[model samples]
Target chain A: MDKKSLTRRLGRPVLGTVAALAMTAGMLGTGPAKAAESFKIGVVTFLSGGAAESFGVPAWNGGKLLIEALNRGGEVPAPYDKKGFGGMTIEYVLVDEAGGATKQVQEFRNLVQREKVDAVLGYVSSGDCLAVPPVADELKAFLILYDCGTPRVFEEASYTYVFRTAAHAAMDNISLARYMKSKGIEAKYFAGINQDYAWGQDSWADFVASMSVIQPGAKVKTALFPKIFAGQYGTEISALMREKPDLVHSSLWGGDLQAFVLQAGARGLFKRAQVAFSAGDHVIPQLGNKMPDGIILGARGVNGLAAKARPNALTTWFWDAYTKEYKVFPVQAPFRMVQGLLGLKTAVEKAMVANGGKKPNAEELAAAMKGLEWDAPSGRIQMTLGGGHQAIQPNAIGRTKWDTAKGEMTLIDVEYYAAECVNPPDGTKAVDWIKAGFPGAKCK
Target chain B: MTLLRSVPAASALAFAALVLAGFVLPDWAMFLVTMAFAKGLVALGIVGLMRGGLVSFGQGLYFCIGAYVSGLMANWTGITDIFLLSLLGVLAAGAIGTIFGPLLANYRGIFFAMLSLSLSMILYGALSKMTTLGGTDGLNVAAPTFLGYAPEGRPLGLALYLYTSAIVVLVGGLMRGLFNSQRGLIALAIRDNELRIEYLGASVRTAMAINYVIAAVLGGLGGVISGLAIGHVDPEFSFWTTSGEFVFVAILSGYLSIPAVFVGSILLEVVRSFSNLYFPNTWQLALGIFLLLVIVLLPRGLGSLTLRRRKAKEQA
Candidate 1:
């Protein structure tokens, strides 16, 4: 071949490569633009990094599964379709909030303004939930708050477009307290180790209040609020050991919890006291045999009573599929995803009905979300509008047990606590809830 | 002289275009541009350190501090005003930087970077454990407030983008001006040969301390804007990866110009956003791949790429 022909051939390949690269870039850049007509739903959660990955990843998976199921199964059949809207294909834009509020807002704004997503879903952290409500209200975008358990998201400001299906900190905390009382574990000198945030603070407050109410003189000895994802827990463990409390309660989920438990167990922290965790089922099973024996662990919405000889098909299917795919049992995180999808499914159907079979935009979806109720794997739950923009939802508790045959963490003797039992009564909320249990009632 | 003067105008025009695109273009495009500017602030701060031959791995500490401080004030105090909250954040970070200044002055190379990283990690630990301060969960940052008007609930896409662009422009100009000063020359000299600068009766440590303070303030300022822009601040801000990202932005921009840093920041945000949009699970991995490509293909950084191309043209 002549030098000129060789040069021309090289030039052709180079041109091809450049064109290919540019085309790739253009395609990657215009993802949301291409999917504009689809019912765009944005999922904001922690999908990368550490702690959030454990729960947030599962939550995302569960959400994806739900979406897949909705798409696969023609419609939600019966009650779900009674509202008049059924069978609509949806597209989702998943964005990592990176487990931070500011990033969440940035991602949320991008979803609303840039992608022009019709609705938003999936937040694993309470802080993100609280951070996003105002933005959602501003955009008039319907947000299905999932995973974030902070009650403050709805309580402080009313966003017509925002609704949370996940059990709030208060709900989980109050339930744990009731479970503790039921167990007759009245030993005092309480100690707490929680992540520093609304959920952590609120959970600690509710626990203390509920414990004080149920068992008097149950003084909290030490309160250790560690930064989320603390690589080491020896120092905090040492302090907890020194305090020498009879019962130890933690809401430590994600990577931090795994690190803490490993370090604490190695240091023999579990041997000294009974342990109660808010998201116990989620974390312990992942621990496998590493989870210490005899630690009284509690998980959110682990109704042991519901798992008789036979359980609901949805619950059974979720458990079987999750284990088969992820090689781990479904936990609180996965359950939260189920709830989030259920919330979306419910709202979309309702909005379709309200709009007289027309597709609902952000405003219609937001309106449909108010006072939303649906049956989840955890059973039926409702998002009731509380004072300000807070959400009132039910909660449950369960003791952790190792299923040796299955090689998994299972909630054995679980009890479902009603929302009213765990919730703060009108005038007396966190303050009164902390006092010794209804001094007037005689074990009724 | 014409090129120098036109730089600001060029930037202003670019920013105006971005803002206009927020209305005319798709929402996703506007979002990518906004993120690009926001991340640019962090990159510029890193450039300040790089200019003095310092590679900071602890920028996240100041970033987290500024963001969390603003977030806390907004949440606990119910002060929805962005400027006031950001001011409080800057003061908090500046106070800490002053203390950190003398301690870090003598350190150089990896030691300086490692020390900074440790400091940020410690802050992360402290924030995570401090329940009253919102711990690992972080604090909610309110929307922008101009005088008495709240911009968060309004037609948010435009005003927010404008605010971000304004900050980026103001900060970029200030950094550029600083880089052109005598101190900037000294900084360059120190990077070239610190021992010679020290022999010339200059207190290398003192100069470094001043530089560090300035960089810290800029970083804190960036954090506040980030907090306002994002509406949430958490302990993760102080993570080593956060600081690494700022470094990445600086290096990617070629540590050359303020606008280049912003461009790099935007590149990163857009790439990450797109990666997540399509790949879903592997956005971080995608970012890693992109960073590797940038490192191999443009060794002098993206800014240097343009400079080198210009020089090649002149030579030809």
Candidate 2:
């Protein structure tokens, strides 16, 4: 074929294809330009994977219930009575937070850029929580990390659009330690076994620091950090038994916690030491009668069975709604989720009122959330830490009593520590504050 | 020989098309393509290994090494240059592969698979325990610069897409060349009959070791690009499931052409993304069903469709 004919043949098709692609692009660009009638929020949690049953599913369920209640209008109490955010029906894009931090980052971007969600609330993994904030900042999207317990998300970087609605991992351990102190439990030599990850390590560090402050003479005997999700704890349990410390502390959760409890209980490891779990409430229902009696445990906050038995109106509503739908009692994951949605609802409403009942932009929403205080099922959650980007909430720790008649584990002798006592105050890092004997802490 | 010679021109054309796509495609599509290409490079490594009758179940070891090297470099040294970080990642993976290659090359079948898996798990265990690397939370990678120019938002995404496309094309061409080379043939021959290769005075172990190192390099390249693209790296990169995903893509590609790996990766991502969107509760089941369908319909994999068509044309 001659060059002219070849060029004529190829050029026409190429030009036509380019025109078609441009038209398609133009059409797609027009699709999302229409003014949104509903306030879209992206809810990301573990819909699959190992953490799904304990953390991801429950949090997602909580989010679903809250959204349903909010959309139903007047189902929740005042300040959140309006249907959704300022009478705009709440629509959600649910994204699974299973595929690691890298995948979560991509999914986060998709939620903001593609799904065009105004706000995002959910992250069960500390890794994902840490990874997502910068992206949220970059996109100028409002993000509320509901379940991840990492304090480093806010400490590592300053962000206006990113806020964690639940207390950091530090609060759980500090409360557990303080509860022991208040109970006059003698723990001179303490041993700890945590999952070898950020959440576990941070919890252990905080626990040690809090113990040092509360029980000034206490010393760390031995500590074991088994890998996260390590189903087998034979060696670690044996090591803990060999140490034979007066008190054993752990922050392991989900399946790992369940597996450890079963293995340790069978091995009579609990008989040798007064065991304390910083975040063990999630496993109580799963463990049932298998859970040992008189074991001290915390639920990251005043959540699960540890929360007030004669609950307030909001707590009763949330517990009932969640239980009706999921057929299980609300755990820390759901507690955090409910708190996040409630806080988001309040902030969005405030912003909407400021904007004359119009849906607030990301900046307005973030502004409303900063330093905001609201009631949660657990108690009041204040964005007081991380320059009002991280939450500080009261946490309850108590001893577990396995009721054979009920075939369930219940928290008895529950003690609630005020948020100020558990969380590091403004301008002070959690680890630094704890190590410095909780300077200026208001322990009650 | 013809196929080998055509690789460069084909790669250049593909590179141009992808570069154009970077500008034309929407943000989400561009991001998805970038991810698929990055993952495809790892799948390519698995493809190479599979061609030699070896299936690695722990390519994630090298992948995580590359990701961590890039992430740690960005975190500790403030080196945001993608080129420098990727080079370091490749070198790090290659160094680790070289150290372990001799030991790994001696095994085959499930033994080889399990050994590689064990090695990756060891890295996963170590990474999960190391607080300096942020433990399970891992560490964030700073936004990378291109030739000293830092870009953000759309510009950043476009830049990353272009850079990733260029790497994919270059690596694809190199892989094609390797497959056509004498050494590649020797490796394939060893897979079929190691005794014959040994009798012919060619060391099967050395060939296997070389292939292993090359696969490691490819995996590391994928890891670095992905880690940089996603702006985070964690121990999950080295987890067994991560490696299994790569293997799944390799099988889906049927150890076929270089482009097949990319296609397979994209398909997997699409299935995963859409499933997660529509069937949040049963996304895993969706993926399982899709895989079953693909296996049942196209036992050799999705790439077999193209091969079968080509064969039909040749016969006619």
Using Cα atoms, each model's DockQ against the true complex is: 0.38, 0.29
CAPRI band for model 1: acceptable
Q: Rate the local accuracy (lDDT) of all candidates.
A: 0.70, 0.85
Local accuracy of candidate 1 as per-residue lDDT tens digits, B1-316: 2564565776677667656655664554555566567657766777888899998899888888778777777777777676776678778888888999889989999899999899999987777767666556666666767667664443454666777777777777777778888888789899999999999988889888887887787778778877776666777788787888888888877776666787667777766766666676687788788787666555557676456546677799
TM-score of chain A of each: 0.84, 0.91
TM-score of chain B of each: 0.91, 0.97
lDDT of 2 by residue, B1-316 (tens): 2563487788888888888777778787778888989989998988888888999999999999989888888888889899998999999999999998889999999999999999999999888878887888888888889989999988999999999999999998888899899888887787789899999999988988888999899889999989988888889999999999999999977865778789778777766776787687888898898787566555566566556657777799
Quote the positional error of residue A117 for candidate 2 in Å.
Answer: 1.3
Model 1, A400-441: lDDT tens per residue? Answer: 556789775555565666655665543334445446453322
Docking class of 2: acceptable
TM-score of 2: 0.92
Instruction: State the local distance difference test value for candidate 1.
Output: 0.70
Best-matching candidate per TM-score: 2
